[model samples]
Target chain A: MDYGEADRILTLLTREMGRISARAPGARRSQKRFAGRLDRFALVAVRLSGPPHRLTLLEAELEEPFLGLRDRLESSAAAAYVVEVSAALSPEGEAQPRIFGLVLEALAHLAEADGPPSPDLLRAFELKALDAAGLMPALDACAACGGPLAGEGIGFSPAGGGAVCPDHAAADPAASPLSPADVHHLRALARAPLGEPRADVGRAAHRRQASALRTFLDAQLGRRPRSAAFLEQVMET
Target chain B: MAEADPIRRLIHQLSRLPGVGEKTATRLAFHLLRADRAICLDLARALEEVSAQVGLCGRCANLAAIDPCPTCRDERRTDDTICVVERPQDQWALERAPEYRGRFHVLHGALDPLSGIGPEQLQIASLLHRLAPAAVREVILATNPTVEGEATALYLARLLKPLGVKVTRIAQGVALGSEIEYADQGTLSRALAHRHDFG
Candidate 1:
């Protein structure tokens, strides 16, 4: 975020630090210190100083800039959404090599993608991130009861923590209708490797899956990410 | 205290400006009080006049006293080429250089999705409206070389390319008077990647 005049308040997610916000003085105006190394989604190795309460960025070297992501709008928006989600899921000052690797892989895939990425890519990233954070929603069994989730009228409840059978669906008013196909797709996404390509799930199913994950994420984060809405706008346009 | 005293109120307002702390604001307030009355009065009048008269230009989003900004209204500049910039300050910086004589279109800001800044929040619709007449033959994207600025430029390029207009981005490289050895790695890498043959 832009701070007073030439300064910038940077929120960085690292493998060692997890997530930390630091003050970079003269980052906006001066070219010598930061020098385009602080671009969003760019992996940088930074040297920080000062007390633990308030760390100041002294130097930063760009590791993987992922410059290809800036070549198109869809890719850029997707990258932003991924980074926002990763940062939100990560805790402050904790080691999160898994999540850091997941984010780096996702961004690298998007950067090297042939065209605008499919919505499934985002869904896959969401599932993987949730898994990395140990918050993966209950997909195989009912969230309310450890019973099998089968039959029509199955609901996915963010409040109930995942897939809810028809019997427990009435308990949560916020539960949205989830089809068997969507449940299977979510399960497959959760289990699939990050680099593997998946078939398109069609537009309607994509919307349903995106909405389900969005509600689940909102419940986890306590609020929707601003970039999610922007991503929707860009995709629609 | 600020509500009761004009001096305190002035200091409070000045302190809200970027980079100005309460101490600096107080110092400035006392300095203004000790200075000539005409100088202080002139400064106040200038501020009031600017705040009252300066509004965004309808043609290009730059702040201007008139409907169309002076740059947009100038007959000497060509209408076929429009230089797109992120802010009015960027437009002014380009104006300092005498090489380009094209008109300008200001987007006010770039696309920063994380900050909730998207195409709808900017003057993108106005820019597209200006291009609908088919008068502009080329659009020079002069947005900053930052990530957000690059995203904005690329987003505009994607949208403008479908409209059949020639779209181009400003060159990125090392700054003049800067040593190559002292330049940062990212800048040097980009400079090398975008290198051209010398005359």
Candidate 2:
């Protein structure tokens, strides 16, 4: 959002600082300090000044502007979703290098990915992000009753934080049905490397997992991420 | 807060404007109180008339007193070329040069995912609609050289290229009168990367 005159208050997620807000004075009017480095998903190195509570952006060197992702609505939206998720999951002032690296890797893939951003890319990132945040949804067995999944069909319980057996699922209003194929795909997405051909579960399945993962994530976060709307619009259009 | 209601209300409203602090707002209110009644009335009327009379152009989306605006209605401007800008102010800045004879398209903003300004939020659909009817051959993207602006331009280029229209971006470099030593590394590097052939 626009701030006083040319200044911008930037919220950034980083390896050193999990999430931080810094004032970029004159960023909007002058191309000298921040210019292209301040946009979403741009990797930058910055010089900071001022006290710990009120850091100011002194200078920024753009590492990668992710210009490729900016070229298409779908790609940009997909990238935005991951960026929002990354920021939300990471707590401020606590360093988590793994999460930071994961975000950078995901963004780089989004920028270089050859088509309209693959839904699987986002799914994969979300899975890893959840794991990094120590919120990985239980998929190995039923989240309730401590029992292994018995059939080809199962139900996902967002509140339960994983898959639930049929008995519990029937009783739990929050449980949504998931096919064995979806379970397989979700497992693959949680651990598989991005762009792995093995993770190609077809577009319809991809869309299903995307919706499910998003719903589950929202439930976990207790608030719908802002980029979810943009992602939906981009995919729908 | 002021002791009087009118003065307090004026300061409150004035402070809502960008960059106007409480001190500045109070100072402006005091100044206005001492000014001639004619000046205050004229300022009020201008504000009212601007809101009532000024509207965005249907074609270019520029804020104007009439639909289509003078720029869109001008026959002398070529239909084959269109210069796209992030805001109406940018179009005016470009117009200061007077060398380009093409019409304009104002996006009102750039692609900023953080702030939720995307393709649908801008005047992109209108720009695309104008292209075919006008037989547009080339598009000059004059969006600011900022990150969002470049991204918006690239996004537009990708969208417009399949239509067989040529897409180009405005050149970014050191200002004409600026010294090389004063230019930032980003600008200098870009200038070197996008250097043009000289006679």
Q: Give the TM-score of candidate 2.
A: 0.85
Question: Which candidate number would show the highest TM-score if scored against the true structure?
Answer: 1
Q: Per-residue CA lDDT of candidate 2, range B83-145, in tens?
A: 999988889898898889988999999977666777899999999999877489999999877
lDDT of 2: 0.81
Interface RMSD of each: 2.1, 3.4
Candidate 2 chain A has its poorest 10 consecutive residues by lDDT at: A31-40
Which consecutive 10 residues in model 1 chain B have the weakest lDDT in total?
Answer: B181-190
Off by over 4 Å in 2: A29-31, A49-52, A172-174, A193-199, A235-237, B1-4, B27-39, B132-134, B158-164, B172-199
Model 1, range B1-199, lDDT digits (tens) per residue? 3468899898888888877767878999999999999989999999999999999999999999999889888999999999999999999999998999999999999999988888889999999999999999999999988778988998899789999999999998889987888776667777888999999
**Cα lDDT computed for each candidate against the true fold:** 0.88, 0.81
- In the order shown, the candidates' DockQ scores are 0.61, 0.37
Q: What is the interface RMSD of candidate 2, in Å?
A: 3.4
Candidate 1 — what's its lDDT? 0.88
